[model samples]
Target chain A: MSFHDREFKKPDFNRISDVIWEVPTSFKQGMRVPAQVFTTKKLLGEMDAHVFDQITNVATLPGIVRAAMCMPDGHSGYGFPIGGVAAMDIENGGVISPGGIGFDINCGMRLLRTDLTWKDVEPKLKQLVNLLYDRVPAGVGSAAFDDAAGFAKLSHGQFREMISSGAEWCVEKGYGWKEDLAVTEEEGNAEGADESRVSDKAVKRGLGQVGTLGSGNHYLEIQVVKKENIFDEEYAKKLGIFPGQVVVMFHCGSRGFGHQVATDYLQLFLSVMESKYGIKILDRELACAPFTSKEGQDYFAAMKCGINFSFANRQMIAHRIREAFAQIFGKDAEALGMRQIYDVAHNTAKLEEYEVDGKKKKLLIHRKGATRSLGPGNPNIPKAYRDIGQPVIIGGSMETGSYLLVGTKGAEEQTFGSTAHGAGRTMSRTRAIREIVGNTRDMPRDKARAIERRKVEELVINPMIKKGIYVKSVSYSGLAEEAGFAYKDIDEVIDATAKADISKPVVRLIPVGNVKG
Target chain B: MTMSYHFVEDVSLADVAFEASGKDLKELFESAGLAVTNTMVRNLASVHTKVTKTVDVEGSDVENLMFNFLQEFVFLKDAERLLFGKIKIDEISEIACKATLYGEKLDSKRHDLSVDVKAITYHMFRVERTREGWQAFVVLDV
Candidate 1:
């Protein structure tokens, strides 16, 4: 058995509120602050023990402000738990760590709104899905779409421009509309992206992947807002989301380009961490350098390139999606009212000013598998959404429904304006494979694998089809690993966030069709 | 006979995890490489040996060497769109490893793909010398 296989006991928590649990600094040594978990009693019990260990470790990091926090969907991960949040004071001796911000930088969610309803899309759902599946490449090592439809081939100069400009480059190239950027976080182009800071290897890996949807829980889905599921009708209407209306939501991040950037920086930081800055970490994954150090600034600039790359990636996918719809319905996407609602990144480290100890301070906030939820009246939000707050997209398992939520002021006060990213995994992928396919140890290797494939069809595909949800996947075995049973209840996770007032639910969108990567 | 690799349970909730054991460092590197490749493609046999790539990487220790070695396959997948079904480790020491990877350019039609292994993560990543041989534990960000 491996060291990770060791069972950990849940820690005793002090009740802060119904949805808030706190672990004092006394619970662990070398702690600078307490750890807060925004989850219900039931979810707390279901959380992995490593979450407690990891979050406490996060609290021990230098110059951490207030408390290290985990969203309701928090789960144990390397270094920091997934759905973890930490704010490092820049003026102080704070540090920036790549582990805190996942490898897939800005791996986020995007939603497009359409005026068409279920009645309009139901008839051609399968055709639309198949076209989407073809137009947008999915799964492992997926290259860009055909040259005619994709910007897969680019000169070195052009690649640098795209990485620096992000979705802004797409809009200028006619791949997206100008209005789409307004609703997007950072208007689809994060500030301070320096092409020189990014490595040639990262560029090579990201060059051809602009329009691709990579594998592993990443997907593009057609969903509908059922009339009854609309929670705040006023906010939904403000966001241009109508009951029964169809929308397209997809999740991905800076593909290999981002991975390489994180890897390169982690290696560099690890080399200089002890001798250059004398920072010690409980886990090697928590490698870091002083926020003001040359290494930290370099990584930040390079990371922004990854953030911009994802914005471009999702923007290109949105273009292909619009084309697919237009080809299917024989009407241009504009006439069909294909407008973007919002695009939000769940993994990132951004420098923002927040009131700390009653003084406004600039802090580099790292959100790993957590979404930024800015409340109303924030200047960072677009003009159209300033009064309503940022739109927070929380995707659930494909079988379960996803949600459209709005940021609340409570999030700013309690969580540094952060919220849960998704219905966090409750079971491992291997566990899902075995539990769904049943025992096949006696069967031959190929035969056992075949049974697993068949079980995915019979148990996952067939049932989904019966319920009128059309699915197109590159691999059935990959789809089996994402079975709905492998995740926590989305509704429960949403309830926890709402009760905590970190985010307010707007609409619950059920999947009508899916293109799984 | 020693097992080359086996999927581990109860480690990571979202990503894939596996433990690979070999009688020596060379075998250990081979088994670990296969584990990384196998996580992406369901059947290595489906990826025909149409291409061969020579891999050379160095690290400070066994753990770092293993990390760098496994990353080669991940980098190949993204940089060249290549998949290696077979790994032949010619040399492996505490500080370095040299290997040959044999596979083909990914053809979605022929390859039974599973998930894109985004990167080899250091979370719970370990490599150690055991009583009989060398064993490594790896968790991949899929």
Candidate 2:
């Protein structure tokens, strides 16, 4: 049934705590387990009805272990709502669905801390932003490296090695510092990546798109660690963040490569979902296969390749950002103290061991639009930051500020070590466009103005400019759509995250410059 | 034959969706292609035939064919940087179709690029024949 026609009662949420809400299994027919949602009472009221429907649909998937969970930033997505998290038991017919990982596989955030302060960069904001906008190829159909010239030089075997090696390959090629690898999630390489499983079309799409910042919420921002916003001063200092300290953050993914890999596998899963697996799904986007099956194994291998591609993609971009800083600040990247704090992937289905029912069990956890927030003493964290737990970068809209947080043990017990990814969208892109530009779908060609080139800036851009944040983008319409008003309030979302004890806020950053695609 | 298509509001806060219909499969495919193109560029009339590419895709069923057909345009846009203003489906069947696409390389100066559609999603994706015509609903990942 369509969403409009479907009948749903206000889900009976059992208040597990002040911030934790649970929809018991009785809420839906096919649900094998309950659904856990983390949000404040007010934020929960703000969610659309479809968010509950989509999360309940996820609860019905085969082999789900505990409950289908959503983070504070949860919103309706295609098959699975964004900010969804669920773990499946491999032995109990657990399945792998591309919808769980999202189209942009390994789409994630990376943060870099620098010794420079906001005062140092504010004077040259325009030049620095323009330089970054130029150096990093962005927007639709933008490619930084020409594939024919670059990949053509490498033999097929060498290209395979690069894909298999992930960020290490980029480091070996001198794209990043060797130390950067340790701070990256999974050490920048996911195991079991077999390039042979990756389709040629996916490979072709990936060739030259490395280091490109893609459109639609993907961006690079120069931010300042605001002293007044720091909630945990000791922890913030331990992370090398301080008042007025300058930092860089960017959000991106595997680009066309990841999209194609997800597309290829979704098609395969759809073709066999009923015949080989005997599984039924509520939505076509939820197509999946048993995790141990050949189809699932193949997708996992190819998905690893996508994950590797993303790691390499961010590594390359990090190198570029460093160069841009060095060029503008008149100091080498090292002397500028531009070191990586951590990198985390929001869209991924990883096989990990977690304790369930006081027994350690292997589960394939799918986190879409959610970040892994592993608590302190987790051996997986880099040795340097193990005492403070993994750093979770929660990016806000260009106009709102972002936050740096630390994982909590409570999250590991409550939600598979996952937390909110960002300030989720509150309005659809069409609605955002309609708000900025008058109706043009029915207008004549001559009457249709280029909203991107319109001289009059929207109300959103004005405030950002007044705040001394320089914004550069390929399209003003795109910029308007991503305005802070279009998304949930970052402060409220983080407040829910902290109150829920999934993650604790360390520092808040105000944007000084933003480069949008 | 009359062909029609219109953008529809999806529940997704980040993506876009559309509904397209035509008298038959050929017209339906063409209308869907146009709808997808319109999401990227501001004005379809402004895009000229500076480049032409043939897209040949095959699938096991009509639904798969629609998925592949729409995905081909996304691939072409990123791989070759071409944005088609016009699409002509020369051949079509339940399993396969061959089409010619006409457009120009994406130019920021000339083309007002809107949403960057990352990929086509199968969320609520449908292709069916009604008494009035063939209709399809598509959700795009932006």
Candidate 3:
């Protein structure tokens, strides 16, 4: 059989509506619902077999509602698959699975707008980039205070406070401005967080590392606007953006705290799930427990801790950036218009009300490698952005362009207020190192990198990695994934969504410089 | 003299019944903290801090003591901008001890910020002994 056929059989691309395609449950056993993948021929060609399997696996989970939907950047991941979205009803025996949340918990991204444009600070770009890089900790176990950020940092008391307070803790400690909290996702914290549920190891890992940026696909980038006026310039100006102006965008998350949360739950669920609920998982990574169960409550509470810690982290980084800017410019960052635009979590599971069967129902939505792209006038949205809707920050690679997009009403009918996070890797990191890295054909890692070796070296040192790495000898049909060249051109993926009218672009950002650990 | 160090991929988890062997509980806790820091960055000598902050941590037992020590690293890294450098064992006891670790504010131009350790995990995590002194595997979650 063709490698694709063995893994995916035939793609049941039955376009159910204008945008949704249904892969019926008959395609795979144990599927509670059908998979609704949002893509076209153009986008489908860019996806791999594993992504198909991931979508299928998600549909089979207990208490899953609607369709096991995937965004445009869908790729093979642990249980839920990156770019995959599924909603489970809490009252209907809905199960909370670690695979749904992934190991990163609330892995997310944020964009900060500054009054000073590239033209205003072009002369001082060198100083700004260097300073930001120096202050923020990066790479593995790269906690802010600890030499080795691990489970030890979280401990008992500190871990409890972080989960309960969310970003308020950081604000109380003066790491960020009080006003900054208004524009953040969930007001920079989740209310349901109960630290009592988190394990001792998870607590120690999180306690002091709340504000640090860890490595492996996590980064801080200093980028420049590639093009403007894709939308109204007046709005862009209001967002503190100008053509050729410099902007800072960062991608990091709850660090080891979240990883431990998902890891601990994955292991716990593995042992208790089948025995307690008679649930059989399609993938070990997809281990789950009923939402009403003790295990589920504990995981949710602990996951909230990770979510809040991430908000605290980004908040801290923002404060430090403001300080650095003030030190150099001799002016307060706020006075200079350096404030947060919006912060969004990409990988997470949340309770949200979306229309189902022409009625609004509350469901737990798990979006891995997908950002919530809520539209305007929703009570959940901050009042300031009510006119324009929530700003969706999509982070591309260091070499490619990141985007600022606004959610549309059309997306509500299509996606559950969600959009792709980035150029989902077609190739695993190991494959990238072996095939794409050090290769002449690969694009420059970034404009500021003196040599490409530094980026490649980091990839080599990346630890705590996971990949199925299917063997051809065992299956004769596993050929599509390798790394870099495997993904479709990211710009094209964005354009496809644009054509579908899912999200309209505001600005495209190309990385001028970046540091990846 | 600078020395070439081998890359210990999974240092936090040992292969065998490799646990730290210290005569006293204080020694065991101290060794646990040391084991964790050494596993993360390349070497302690490469890190230094002119700024000094005192860490006074006490937990009920050996396991909790290790927990407090890990929390200390997190506190110092975020608020003080100090990454752990070296461990100076001043006093050791069943419930508490004093250790002075060396670190400085993060300087990108001057020093490399090696890794953003999210937290340490207890997967195969333990304090153990080596022939030279005391050693333990501290599995770090990167």
In model 2, the runs with Cα more than 4 Å from the true position are A1-9, A145-159, A444-447, A450-456
Count of clashes in candidate 3: 42
Candidate 3 lDDT by residue in tens digits, B67-96: 556656744553445666655667765457
Docking category of candidate 2: medium
Rank order by TM-score, top first?
A: 1, 2, 3
- Report the C-alpha lDDT of model 2 over A1-517, residue by residue, as the tens digit: 4322345456878999889889998888889999989999988888877889899999999999889999999999988999999899988899999999999999999999999988898898889889889878778876774333363244445656877988999899888999999999999999999999998888777776888888889999999887788999889988888888999999999898899999999989988999988999888888999999999999999999999989998998898899889999999999999999888999999998888878898999999999999999988888888998889999999889898999988888889999999999888887777776757767776556644335227466777889878898887677877878789999999999999999999998899899998
Q: Best candidate, TM-score-wise?
A: 1
> Which regions in candidate 1 have their CA more than 4 angstroms from the true location?
A2-4, A439-446, B1-3
**What is every candidate's C-alpha DockQ against the true complex, given to 2 decimals?**
0.72, 0.69, 0.10
Candidate 2 residue A261 Cα shift, in angstroms, is: 0.5
* Tens-digit lDDT string for candidate 1 (A407-498): 98999999999999999999888888788887653466578678977899999999899877999999877788888988999999999999
Better of 1 and 2 by DockQ: 1
Q: Report every candidate's CA lDDT.
A: 0.91, 0.87, 0.64
CAPRI quality of model 3:
incorrect
Please identify which of the two predictions, 1 or 2, would achieve the higher TM-score against the true structure: 1
